[model samples]
Target: MCNTFPAVSQVDTGASQHRIESAAALGTLVSSTASYLTVLLSSPAHASASESLSRHHAQVLWDLADIDARTAGLLARILQPFLSIGILLMIIRIVLSWYPQIPGDKLPWSVVVKPTEPVLGPTRRVIQPVGGVDISPIIWVALLSFINEILLGPQGILNLLQRKIDIS
Candidate 1:
């Protein structure tokens, strides 16, 4: 008996092609809209009065410029909340370090110290106390601050990634 079906079926090829074309069209539309909005919103008069707004809009334009930049921007946005939490926890830990007798089960205060021990323990071991003061919390705050800068600051990894994406 001879085989009737071909190795590669042509079924749905037109549909797939149409889907691909639609996706390309949608992408182009989105990019064009972003560029238009950037130009419309980035007038010097508006930007000069609101530096934060200007920076935010500029970053959005940068992210929309390429896939890698967009991914980096998205990652940075997702990580921002966690970074805020980390900073808050570090601040609490620093306060806790000032008091040696606050029990972990202490009401109201436990909320601050308990959540931060896991983060502080390793640093405490590595950093050691400075002049009889536990400096681990401060160290962690500094480290987390540094990490926040690397990942999300204006001249951060995302910006570097955007530059690389543009270069390529």
Candidate 2:
């Protein structure tokens, strides 16, 4: 049955070969440590045994504290919102794209032709072409990429790891 599929057989054999030794070593260490602690704690000399157990417990707690610190630092680095500005810009652009323009009501040719005063009060008459370019999306994506790759990329993970190790 095992030999029927060569790929499966090979993978099974390889996995067993590679992992079995490590698994056995880990199991042995765990069992031995547990047995030792149990024996140490269950000894008749309660004071000495309690002190030893407390010391071992404290060491374990310290190790766990270090691990937590390192993990938190790594997560902080990885989860930093580098693309937030770009994302916000993109959202604004999307909203603007959906904006409804004011409808122009039809009027007499004379009224339409005549240059009316700007309704919103005094304004400079800059002869800009109607429906110019909208490059907000492009700018947003470019900025997002820049921030993600430059400001937050190299330093994030490395700095996180360094800080974690340093604190530990």
Candidate 3:
């Protein structure tokens, strides 16, 4: 007996097309990232960080933060206070958070909010607040403080580099 039903054509779900597109996008992303890393690993003068740092006998602090010793002192001075100021702003934001009635757009509050929002906005999305309270400000404070201690503290990376520059 012959079948009476119409033969349905296979549907093109575009899975193969999607996969090809996805693979191409991923390859492009990888290539882009590799190029970026290549530049970052290399110095402003196009020298490797390891290669540049090797010239110095003082081997305590070696990182991507400073590739040239000429700028180490300036970097330390600027970065130390930058981190401190970040922590201070976060603290002020934390205090501002305590007073919910204060409008964020007003003077003083706006000054604090404008600077800290860029940081806190992304942080809140990544880490949800505990209980009913928002803790991003506090978290940022801790992060800045920790960074300050790590890169600018006594025996810190940049501080050591700064010392190295001072000695030479």
Candidate 4:
């Protein structure tokens, strides 16, 4: 039997190299995220912030890295949709608050207060009367926006977590 070796074309060789590099990078990211999560979970005070927030940030990065889409990542993915729901709730509340003529006890509008009342109740007490106008919705919107920035913004917690992971 004669042994023969097939010639490797430049394109094939380049593609293989690219795949190898991508795998290496992915491996590094996975390890880094795992290590960081371990430390963060083991020591609650390691990161100075709300425990849940810290966990969420870790989860976000872990998901983005696509190392594993298991528990943490799955939970982290909920934050975006949760925030979207929150914004929608706030908008409905704001609209209803704006037009007193609209009967809120009716269907559709009835559900708006259920989720938003808890938040608006406390906020209304804090914000002084704006010429008899309830500005609590605006305040809530601002607060939610701020939260979104902190948790989901480009230079937000995810980046911070990634940097820390990269450093270690």
- Candidate with top TM-score is 3
Off by over 4 Å in 3: 1-69, 165-168
lDDT of 1 by residue, 5-73 (tens): 111111113321211123343365456545545665676665354664455455444324333555565
Q: Mind giving the per-residue lDDT tens digits that candidate 3 earns over 22-82? A: 3333344345444544654664654455553443212212113323444555667778778
Best by lDDT: 1
Question: How many clashes does the backbone of model 3 have?
Answer: 0
lDDT (Cα, tens digit) per residue for candidate 4, span 69-160? 23223334667788778888898787787788887778878788778888888888888659878889888888888887786677656334
lDDT of 3 at 95: 86
Q: What's the C-alpha lDDT at position 66 in model 4?
A: 32
Per-model CA lDDT versus the true structure: 0.61, 0.42, 0.60, 0.58
Q: How close is candidate 2 to the true structure, as a TM-score?
A: 0.25
Instruction: List TM-scores for all candidates, in order.
Output: 0.53, 0.25, 0.59, 0.52
Between which residue pairs do clashes occur in model 2?
Answer: none
TM-score of 4: 0.52
The 10-residue segment of model 2 with minimum total lDDT is 115-124
**Model 2: residue 100 alpha-carbon error in angstroms:** 5.0
Q: Clashing pairs in model 3?
A: none
**CA lDDT, candidate 2, residue 140:** 52
Ranking by lDDT: 1, 3, 4, 2
